[model samples]
Structures are given as structure tokens and as C-alpha cells.
Target: MEAKGDGSAEADKADFQKMIQGMLEKAKQLKPEELVFRYKGVLYPSVPSSVQTLQALGNFQARPEDLVISSYPKCGFNWVNLLLRDIAFINQNESEDGKPGVRSQLKLLEFENAGNYEEMKNDPSPRIYGMHGHYNNLPSSIHQKKTKILVVFRNPKDNAVSYYHFCQNNPLLPTFSSWDEFFRNYMTGEVCWGSYFDHALVWEKHFDDENVKIVTYEELKENLAKGVQSIAEFFGLSLSEEQIQKIAGRGTFQAMSDNAEKTHSSFGKVIFRKGVVGDWKTLFTKEQSEEMDAKFEACLAGTKIGAMLKYDLYCKE
Candidate 1:
């Protein structure tokens, strides 16, 4: 029995190593421009995803009770997902040892293979997905079913800084030679998931959409308890003040970072770095700041989402 168990463990290790090597080889095959592949005018990361996955997403089905947390890369996608999962677990009275089981990972709608999609479809209802694509790229069933969507966004400057660091640390992502090059690419919508402005603008039109709710990283960081309550209400799940406080306490940046290894595995460090509002001040050059400002004004000025960004407070020097 012991020998069989040891053999099974060894085989699992070998399979894991093989998967990693395959991913590295695929990353090596991509040219800089090919790092992010385009499908239907939107960009997706080439590593860990394929055109087939995107095609599968086009015909993907969504249940009405399904909830989605959508964001551009590095825009609090993971954090918000954690909170919503906690809310769901709490609301459903699904707790183990008096604690909410919120560490389970949610599926990324854009990265799943056909088999995975089938698995998700067959799984129980109230499925939560983390999405990083534009609104139009969402599964048509999501729209037709009026699935509730939560869109999380961050100020562009801070988002770019975080995204740069993430790329540098994540082997699955292509790294830039310098922040300057990355900044230029980011401003032009060359990065994975395309321009942040484009994403914000498209989602902006849905501000009044009954099924969609928008939140900001800064808003959550400022008063997480309030954010938690708002999200609970948005999901039609009423929670007591005590429950909100407990969830917010567990969802803090420091708490999440400390638990990242257990919750996110090897990618935790790359995902949860200095979750602050103005880290961009340390990285963005004056010219880059001006450029982002110009783009924001042109694309989102006077918009509801623009006001939510609080750009003048957190973005400007």
C-alpha cells in the first residue's frame, strides 16, 4: 500500500512538471506582438489560453443565478471575487468550523477550455466567474439571462503600475523591457484585454443597466465594510452589520496577502502586491501621467465612472 501511494505521488509530480514545461515552451514560441492574441478585435493573453477557448466562450451558456465579477487585469478582480464568494457562503449558511469557505477559486470565463466549460455548465447554480474581457466578449447567455454582473475598476495610473509588476513576476505573461515600453503599449490598447479606457467606456454605457453594478478598488480600500454591504445588497442578499464587519475584516489587503499562498498557490505573490491607491505616484513619469490624463478626459470625462475614479485626487501629482 505504501509503495503504491508513493508511486502515485511521483506520477502526479511528473505530470505537474510536464505541464509547467509545456507552458514555458508555449510562452517561448510567442513573439512580443504575439504575446497577446486577438479574437474578434479583443486581446487575450496567449499563454494558458488559446483561440479555441475564446471560441468556446462565444457559445458558452450562463445560468440566471450566475454572478460575474469583471475587470481588466490587475483591477481588483481577485479581491472582489473573494468578497463575493464570502458573501455567498455567508448568505447560504455554508460555513465550516464557524468560518466562511471563501478561499475556493472561481473560474475565469475567458481562459477555460471546452471541457472545463462543460464541467462548469454541469456544476450547480450560483456559479461565480472572474472575467477580464470587454463587455461584448461576454457569453451571450450572460446577456440573455440578465445575469448579474459586478464590474470592478481602478484608476488607470495605479492599474498600469500594478499590471507592470504583475507581468514582470508572472512567467505566464510577457515582460516588458521597461515601464516606458509597457506604458506606451498600455495606452494604445496593446496589452491583454485591450485598453483600460476602452473597457471602462464600454462598461460605462451599462451604468444604468439594471443587472450590472460597478465598484472601484479605491472605494473598497477606503471603507471595505461599506463596500461589502453594498455588494451584499446588490446581490439581493441581506447581511447583518456584524456579518459585514466580519467579512471586511477578513478581506483586508494584509489579510488577503498573508493568506495568498494558501488561497492562490504559487501565483499569490504576483497577484496581491501593495494594494494601495496611489502607488502609481512612485512609478508614473510626468509625461506618462499627462498622457493618461489626456486619454481619460477624451474617453471618460464627465462620465459616471470617471467621477468614481476620483482621478484628480489619486492620479494627479
Candidate 2:
């Protein structure tokens, strides 16, 4: 009886320490105002990637061979996460030989275990990772290594709509009840990730490097087979074309949304919701589209992105 009590007491102490630590960390991070974090743009404050090294946030411990998926929010992050999840890790399929009951998906790839950047570095064997971080926030070391980066960019109009729902459901953001308030903040780049224009530009510039490759969410949606091939090649993974097609088919926007619903959230909503590319058609007014285009032109100026984007004309559906 005494020993059990002692064990409970130790657990309580550890929990208390964790609570206090979390509070202190939160205190250190700048307050979110109008959705933009004051000291945050690409750089984030102490956000731990793992329980082991809880405070070494944002710093990259990258090597050249590592694979990083960088995307703006609502830009196929979950799709890529699920894709890399399958490619990078596999479970022992009920082999007659006993292994632990089953493996948690977390143990499969590098991203599952990492709560922040630091933990992303601690994985084994050609590690794969994901982040919503803007271009400037990435570590210089990672850049110098010429680490293989897969960047996913989506049209900002749709991103804005998706981000609105995400923030509404996200506990961390100061919730605004009205779309009017949300759109104002979003247009001004006052939210967590900042101006979608600036963020996308940074990523586009990075793709100029040999090791960096850009993929569009629209392209991925239209033809996931090719998207899978592009990403797989970027990470130096070769698979048969047929196998790649299979992966693309399985990791669809609809499938992920349906699968995520069964999950119970300790946080606000289930992290993965609808993955459709252009719910914005229903949401964006003509004036809003024009206003959004002004930002796009300025950010995408001097690039051939305009023609490519014109041809694809995503979000029409």
C-alpha cells in the first residue's frame, strides 16, 4: 500500500512539473493579436518537438539526406503526412511471430514523434518530417545541407477559407465568431502564419535550389499520381509507377476526412477535416477574388507562376 502511494506521488510530481513547464513556455511565446503573433513570422518561440528535449524549438538538426515537407496550412499537409506515413514506415502485419500488439503510427516516421523541430532531428534512417513553417523560419544548417525539401503551395483564397475554419476550431488562436472579423485579419496577414503572399513567396524562392522541389495542391488534387512521383523522387525514393498510383489513390482528400472523424480529440477538433481543394468558390465573393489577386500578383511577380496558375484555374469547382 505504501509503495503504491509512493508511485502515485511521483507521478503527480512529474505531472505538476510538466504543467508548470508548459505554462512557462506559453508565457515566453508572444501573445497572438488579430491572429498574428507579435514576435512570430517565420520564427517561432520555444515550441518543443519532443518530451525528451522539450525546449529546443525551431532549431533544425538536419542532415543533407533528410526529407522535409514544408507547406502552408491547409495545403495538402495531411495528405503528404499520410503519404509519407505510408512510404517511410510500415507495420508488421499480424505475423505469426509475436511482436508487440501493434505499432502506433507515431513510431513509423520522423514527423509523428516530433512535436517541434528539435525532435524531428532525432529520428533514424533517412528521416522524413513535415512543418507548416514559412521559408525564413527554416534553419540555415538545413539549407546549407541542401536537404531535400518538398514545398506545397495552395491558392491563398482557398487557404484563407480553410485557415478560418482551422482557427475557429483551434484552441490556441483567439477565436473570432464572425467571418468579417476573420477575413480582415487574414487579409492583413495578422494571423499565425502571417501574409499568405509573403509565406508562399519565401517557399517559391527556396525552390530555386537544386534540392528543393515545388508541388501545387491543385496539381496534387488533379493528379495525385504525378504528385506522389514528384515527392518520392525529391526524397530519393524510387517505387514502381503502379505502386505510386496506388498510394495516391488511397491518400485522397475524402478518405482522410472520413478517417479522421472516428478519432476523439483531446485538443479542439479532429486535426484532419475536409481536404477539398476549392471550397472557396462558395465562400469567396468576386471582389474578394480580385483583392486576393492583387496580393498574388505582387508576390508572384517576375515568376512564371502566373501562367501556370492561369492554366490550372483551380478553385473554380
Cα lDDT of model 2 by residue, 50-150, tens digit: 22321233344678877677777677666676676555432212224322221112221222223444354464657656566676766566777888787
RMSD list, candidates in order: 4.6, 7.6
Give the winner by TM-score: 1
Predicted candidate 1, C-alpha RMSD: 4.6
Candidate 2: residue 49 Cα off by (Å): 9.2
How does model 2 fare in lDDT?
0.58
TM-score of each: 0.90, 0.73
| Cα lDDT for residue 70, candidate 1 | 91
Q: Candidate 1's C-alpha lDDT?
A: 0.82
